[model samples]
Target: MSSQARRRSRGTLYLALCGLVLACLGFGAALWAQDHTTWFKRLRGGNAWSLTYQGDAVGGQGSALTIRYRFNPDSFKPAHRIEQLGRTHLPWSVHALVNTGEVARVEVEPEGHTVATCRILLDDVRVVAEGKSPAPGRPAVCDVTTSSTPEKWPR
Candidate 1:
């Protein structure tokens, strides 16, 4: 090949290689940005929360009661407090108060009962029952810690 032609071809190949490297770097940076953005959104409470609780009823045939609370992303406060939305099938009324993604307090009142009130605490996977009318064989104020997350609770 002529000297000038050979030099030109080499220059073209170099430019193509450089372009490919830059494109790969750009793609890597974009992927990193996307991953970090998703993490930030979760930390800022941009993701919805689904808290579930399962335990035996206070009385009457020893049936188990399952309570599920769904909190929209907007309803989650920086302090980890979630406001009750509406229209839930929770057997008893619940006051959603979550703290630090670990501790949660829920006030419950059985149906057709006005005097008895109960409080449930979710300490990570552990569930503590308190107040009047607790489950049989379980103390009025007791902690029943489990090794499961709220999402993994039985439906």
Candidate 2:
């Protein structure tokens, strides 16, 4: 082959190799961003998380109760507090994000046979954890600490 033709072919091959390398790097970066950022999770679909409280006493006669729980990205902060649960509010449920190293807690005040059961669900299907407290006239506290991120959730 002519020297000019050989040089041109070599340059083309080098450019192609560079392009391939850049494509691989872009793919890897996309994966890393997906794992590390919430924007990517929103693009695909935010992780589905559900916290539920239920128990025998939930349906039975009981006085107004206090409920506390934590299901946010910030694990250092204290659990959110609410006082709307009562005899009529049995089987309370709410949806929120619960990342790894965080907790799903349900604390019901010791009110007239109050029993509290807590459940944490990921993707609306996977049961991450659950707990129950059934002692009457005693604080019914249920806690579940998650250890791992969901398969599709951002780390």
Candidate 3:
């Protein structure tokens, strides 16, 4: 090919490479948007706990665990035994109606419970307990306690 022809071919190749890079970047952005919203939800019904992960982007109804926690009116850490959890990345949550009333929270207390009690690694920092919001004038929010860490385990 002539010099001019070679230059044209090189330019075309460069453009193709740029296009591929842009496509890759777009795909990465989409994945990030989804991952940013990826989360787990658990709603408590007295003692029984229902847990589910948002496996999809748009919301679905919900999911139920085969092993349910059948306990009294409510109990914290009502997990079905550590062995029952199965290796998983899903976050663990529990809601209990202690004498504290609707005020229940989830925290990664010392698994052995020998270290501490009610040590909160709080999530939803922006909206704290129902009244204690992060905002200045508004009282912090309160209702439930939730926290999560990037750490995960594989099943």
Candidate 4:
């Protein structure tokens, strides 16, 4: 064809390559997309954050699950502090799932607040969780289960 036509085609190809690169980046983001208050998003406590998560929130027909974990500020280099968790932490209100469908009743409570007192009802379901700040001079600690298992992460 003509030189002008060839040049135009070349320019179109460059633009197409750029578009493809951006599309790939977008797809990558979607794969990594996470809810703002997702337990694993704003992880803190440094590497000491032993994240024990499971897909038990939803039954057999569910696509998402609620995760619970704990962190001790002494788990890593103290300088990093809570930076590892980004800006995420417990929220007064959040979302989780249940056996049947969406459990939009997830509740975040300030550590030390009444665990049972904080509950939200949406339509006909309720989601709940609680937080407990470490006792003074004890650093931050979390108990994910009822068993007598207390873990301490030393820096």
Per-residue lDDT of model 2, residues 1-155, tens digit only = 99999999999999999999999999999898877776554445434344444432555545436656555643334344333455445455566655554556666554666665555565566665565564655655666665444443443
- lDDT tens digits, residue span 84-105, model 4: 1222232222322121111112
Model 1 ranges with Cα > 4 A deviation = 42-48, 58-76, 79-102, 105-155
Q: Please identify which of the two predictions, 2 or 3, would achieve the higher lDDT against the true structure.
A: 2
Ranking by lDDT: 2, 1, 3, 4
Per-residue lDDT tens digits for candidate 3, residues 15-108, read 9999999999999998987676423222332222222211111122222221121112534443322212222221233432222122333222
Regions more than 4 Å wrong, model 3: 39-155
Question: Can you write out model 1's per-residue Cα lDDT over 7-107, one digit (the tens) per residue?
Answer: 99999999999999999999999999976875665556533333343223443323213223332233345344334333223334433333233444343
TM-score of 2: 0.50
Q: TM-score each candidate.
A: 0.40, 0.50, 0.27, 0.29
Rate residue 66 of model 1 by lDDT.
26
Candidate 4, residue 86: Cα displacement in angstroms equals: 41
- Candidate 1 Cα lDDT to native: 0.42
Clashing residue pairs in candidate 2, if any? none
- Cα lDDT of candidate 4 equals 0.31
Pairwise lDDT winner, candidates 1 and 4: 1
lDDT at residue 82 of model 1 (Cα atoms): 36
Scored against the true structure, residue 130 in model 2 reaches a CA lDDT of 64
